[model samples]
Target: MLNMRTKAVWGLLALALSAGSVQAAEPEVTDARLSLLPGDSPGAGYFNITNTSDEPLTLVGAESAAFHMTEMHVSTTENDMARMESVEKVDVAPGESFAFAPKGYHLMFMHRAEPLEQGDEVDVLLHFENQPELPVTFTVVAPGSM
Candidate 1:
């Protein structure tokens, strides 16, 4: 027979386990790639971010050892001229996926430490507002490969 205190502790343990399971189902990144441009030019990165939890997820920033700075950018066309702008954060709804592709939302890697070659792999750490920092590997590909 379990005492009242023992029973309460067991109940709390069960609740903690349930909460852990819920946290495990969060946002994730997949199909990540970085474009390799010629010379010392800046490159773009593309990926798909999926939200699996019940609430929305916001991607705040990103960092990489290969570049001096990483920023989220979106391309827009005004009067037939395409331009890119930096964004502070990207919001993703539950059960939805955000695409970072060409002519759309993407990551701008600025001031690279060294020029990235084809088939090179780079590690990028993605920061979120409500979740832990996600470590992602981006494969370097030729320009315009998408």
Candidate 2:
């Protein structure tokens, strides 16, 4: 049988190894961006993210030079009123995607530079809780459009 001290040492080693494996299991997101929404002072983004590893990923915030502030917001109709709410995190399943589109799931931009117009491109950076600083280019679209 192992001594008490030896058992404790083995337990510590196992814990350290487990932690390392978890840290190495994060997935990577590619080609992600915020889509331009129709209206004023706010917009959203759409992107494709692939979770390559075992660990899950969450998108918590975003940043852009064109806007004063960026947040991950969700749209839901409650009591005949269409309202938007902030999301704490967006979880991406392993080998899956989390898309952000208008009128459903999207990024809300505070105090935009100007009214959004089609064919305009801007730089936006997405922040995930697990993987932060994923920057990409964004394009504006016309109203009553996708």
* Model 2: ten consecutive residues of lowest lDDT: 23-32
Off by over 4 Å in 2: 1-40, 114-116
Write one digit per residue (lDDT tens) for candidate 2, span 1-68. Answer: 46988999999999999988764454454444445556654666665666776767777777888888
Task: Give the best candidate by TM-score.
Answer: 1
Q: Residue 115 error for model 1, in Å? A: 3.6
Candidates in order, TM-scores: namely: 0.88, 0.68
* lDDT for each residue of candidate 1 in 1-146, tens digit (9 for 90 to 100): 56988999999999999988765465778999999788878889999999988888999999999999999999999999999999999999999999999999999998989767989999999999978998999999998677
The residue pairs that clash in candidate 1, if any, are none
